[model samples]
Target: MAKLKLTAGRVRAFTCPADKPQAFLWDADVNGLAVRATLGAKAYIYQGRLNGKSLRVTIGDVNVWSLEEYREPKTGKVITPGARPEARRLQALIDQGRDPREVKAEVTAADIAKREKTKQANTPALEAWQAYIKARASKWSERHKADHETMSREGGQKIKRGRREGMPDKKEPGILRPLLELPLSSITRDAVAGWLEQQAYRPTRARLAVSLLGTFLNWCSDRPEYRDQVNPDACTRMKKDLPKPQAKDDCLQREQVKLWFHHVQRISNPIQATYLQCLLLTGARRNEMAALQWEDVDLTWNTLKIRDKVEGERIIPLTPYVKSLIDGLKPARVVLLHSDDALKRSPFVFASATSTSGHITEPRIAHNQALKNAGLPALSLHGLRRSFGTLAEWVECPAGVVAQIMGHKPTAIAEKHYRRRSIDLLRVWHVKIESWILEQAGIEQQKEETLKLKKSTAA
Candidate 1:
């Protein structure tokens, strides 16, 4: 180390000595301030003791010590030394018993954190939504996955089938796509409120969309990157802004079954007609019936292995009328082939060439037409399932049997623990309920022949 009055000329001229490997010229004016000379470059450095520990910090490179004005390259005006002020600042921290290196490290860490936060704030809402789904989709059902995708589907083209409620000709934006367009950080309660208001025309769908969005936001809040940026309370705050879901009690009355069956039979699409009828007679959910495979129906055993929502699978009795309907189908198309002459079988019970799901996805068009012809008010597909539960009351069916048949959770302790009805026990009530429904619909069976066939099949 050599003590000197440091200047631009001397700072630039200093070089590391071969014997020492490096050299330092300590500033005479500033305590512990020095210019270090390596073999390749030079920089202003500070060395001191803070609370008995040695501290060293490089202030700046010698090349960037002055402001450059290339317009007057030869006679550029020289400003004050930049590194001197920085070195003095570090000295002040040392005077306050703080290590300058530690202080710089803290500042550098804070800057890095701020940049990261900014980057996360700019993440698109759709991008975050995708990440959220990818992380948690395994826990969701196939229908749950479809619900999210349907709500966020970008729409501008024409749909081939089923008229949309509001915009029949051209499809409009989906319920949640607008919210997903902006950055995740910008999805405030006010923004969501405005979105909900615009979607108020379809209150039922809007309510569902808001609920799903709230779930997505909750997922975002649990993530460390979005924990601070996303307000977990946004969903709660927007709840008051949403419309309360209306209670639905839509079902067919006893007399209406006559017209319901009449209209359903009139439908041009036989597959959809059978689908709607199956939904009513079995009290099965719409998707469950739509997703029915050929393997699920057992003609000989008179049973259906329905894919249930509550339980994984539920075996239900195939009643007389329902069994006849299944038997009447051209078996050649719905069965496995053993010989070259056998008809080609379709894997799906309700097969179609146009549907992406490889079956009848939406029967709404034909369903609505049926409603119009029957002079009945519009009802959802699920309403038919409800009608089954309602109409089953006519035959004095057991509550537990109907509940189990419908895949509903047991409501009472006895039903949950004490009683587990066998398929034969359920079949008794199920067949009687179907008979009562058919009789109410002005449908009469040839009892003698039917009984004979039943006996023959049993033997």
Candidate 2:
């Protein structure tokens, strides 16, 4: 039988075995006890056995564990080893299907997680945004990141600068300030609706802020720490008053297009003049064109493939005029003249001196400028896209063809499930959109201007 030494000053030592295979008995003189030592260098513990069965519990190094530091794990408290009876009583609960060890571990983990969330809530709103970004941003795509960056300025203003002088990055409003620091648990739909009403006071800005808020809240729900914090509770009446978002559409008429085209051509800024020309010809989003890279265009195929398009990959056939616009552009090779990045800094076709890839970041500025110059109301940049769509309709292009050229998906619901092979439809789309643009530009039909395009059977 192996024995332990009760040494000087009530100190206890389990004399380790010198032999490779050996066993020792510790606290056999008492109940609810454990042993210590190791296979090689690091010592461990084996404790708590019942009947003939021994259960092992490794209590780390002997040098680290002081006898006085030891205590029993039962009775919702710590007790002396002299009260081994109570410790055994608690161990008895485990034998009867209760795990105090696992329970305690869970409690400690819960406390840590709770404290972490508390810290997060206590953090400044912008700082918390940074933390959340560091923890969760890798899952987002590049365009998704860019969109967030743009909204960061558009929703709330944060100051930043470019390498070039005479240019400052445009900032978004601080729409997220009200709820940015609040714990998701404490947030309410009623509070959100009230914030929404505050936004409604501005009409346009409120809708933008609320939409961004809802999107971010949904994003937060995907996080494990924020999973339970989604505020389902809101005052009933406030939910009814949720403001409708303003549509980002700006399609125009043939008459308006005729006027707008001339208006854009007369702009003093050469870059804006060219940018406007390309916008009319391609039927592409203003920002998409602004962000266009030489790599994104296939000059050989005479096609503009926008992979990061607002809709999707919009494959628009290049007209001769479109080709001329590109050729006439000073070859920055890979650079977008509008955006102030690298020779190939951005793959944007249009860019601004500021941040938004295409040097042309804010449409409102351009819209106001164009309208002021053209002697018209301040229509949206997206309005040009709308105008393209509207003009295509005037030329009697099929709705499906127009939608396809615009990179819109088809469905069956039937608009949802049905996929129309738009290759043929796209050909018709090219003819009509191009024709409408020329007609509006007052470019009379030339003898050689005929495009023997595909016929659209759909109404």
Candidate 3:
């Protein structure tokens, strides 16, 4: 290294020393400021020592970066006009016992830290939701998984033809879709409040969406990467503003069951008709009845093993009339009744030809038509299950026995832990309940005829 009055001309003329690969020409005007001349390019360099360690840093170049016209804030005038003005600032830092290289590194580190935070803040909520779902898909049922997908669905385009000719295309994105694209950090309580207000017209759906969103946020917070990016309790703050879910009581009264059954039997689709009647007789959830598999049903045992949400699976007694109804639906009927090509020898007792699941997805349209025909008030399919529970009280059926048959969890300690009733014991109450329900519906016990029919059908 040699001390030189480094000027534009001198800096340009500087070259690598013949004896060495490179050389440094220190500026005589500014200590520790030098021009580094390598084999090809020339650049400004700052040199200093911190804690007995030598520190050397490249300031910039002669042309691309040089003396920027920076006015002193207090003086409002220029003080330095030489090349590599930043070199002088580095020298001042070196004099203050701070390594310019380390300070540069610290500033660089801070910039990186700020960028990482910004990136996390900009992470899309839907992207996070997908990840959350992926992590949890194994634990969730198909219906549960479908609900999450439905919540984030971009609805299909409106059909221009047929019955839905003028209705707005349901293809619009779901309520959660807008929130899904937003950064997790942006889902504030105020944001949720605005969304809730928009959804006030459909209070029930709005409440469910809020609950799901809360679960999603909680999932986000539990993960290390997104913990700082989301507020898990964000949905909780909006709960007070949400409309309370109105309790549903649209079940068939004792008198209505007969008409309901009469209208249901008149439905052209035998499988749909049978499915509705099964819902009433069994007190099973709609999906549970729809998903009945051949393997789970045993005519000999008179037990229908139903996949239940609360109990995992429940064995309900296949009473005489129910046995008659199910036995009549032979393999030929299963094939002939299904209109959809997709349903070919499916094991589901109530298989559908057109459904994606090869089983009835929903029978609301058929059910509604039947209700209209019956001239009865509208009732949800779940109302049938509720009706079963309500009507069983007329026979003085024990609440626990009814709960067991319905796959409801035991509320009392004795029922949950101590009183594990056998299938035979369950059958006693279940058969009695079915007989009582049939009597109320004005149906005779056609046991002999059903048995004779089954034998003839088998032959």
- Per-candidate local distance difference test: 0.80, 0.57, 0.79
TM-score, cand. 3: 0.75
- Per-residue CA lDDT of model 2 for 1-459, tens digit only, reads 444432222223445477745444454433444444445433324356445555554444544543333455565454422223434544675577655455557889999988987776555444435555566579776665654444444343344432223444544455656655555665577567657767665556555555545656565667675666554333334434655555676556666665666666667665567777777666677767776666777778777776645465667676666665665554533444443434555445554444544455554455566767767765666676677677776677777666666666665465556655554457556766786677665655555544222222321
Off by over 4 Å in 1: 2-6, 10-56, 67-81, 91-99, 118-131, 149-161, 164-166, 169-171, 174-202, 213-270, 324-347, 351-356, 370-379, 410-419, 439-459
* Candidate 1 lDDT (Cα, 0 to 1): 0.80
Error of 3 at 142 (Å): 4.7
lDDT of 2: 0.57
Error of 3 at 23 (Å): 5.8
Ranking by lDDT: 1, 3, 2
The alpha-carbon lDDT assigned to residue 91 of candidate 3 equals 73
Give per-residue CA lDDT, model 1, range 282-394, as digits (tens).
99999888888779999888899899877988999988877766555545245333344455566778766556666678898899889998899887899999999999998
TM-score of each: 0.72, 0.60, 0.75
**In lDDT terms, how accurate is model 3?**
0.79
lDDT of 3 by residue, 279-386 (tens): 987899999999998788899989999999877998888877788887767653345234444435667788776666777777877888889988999898999899
Query: Top TM-score: which candidate number?
Result: 3
- Sort by TM-score, top down from the best: 3, 1, 2
Worst lDDT run of 10 residues, candidate 3, spans 450-459
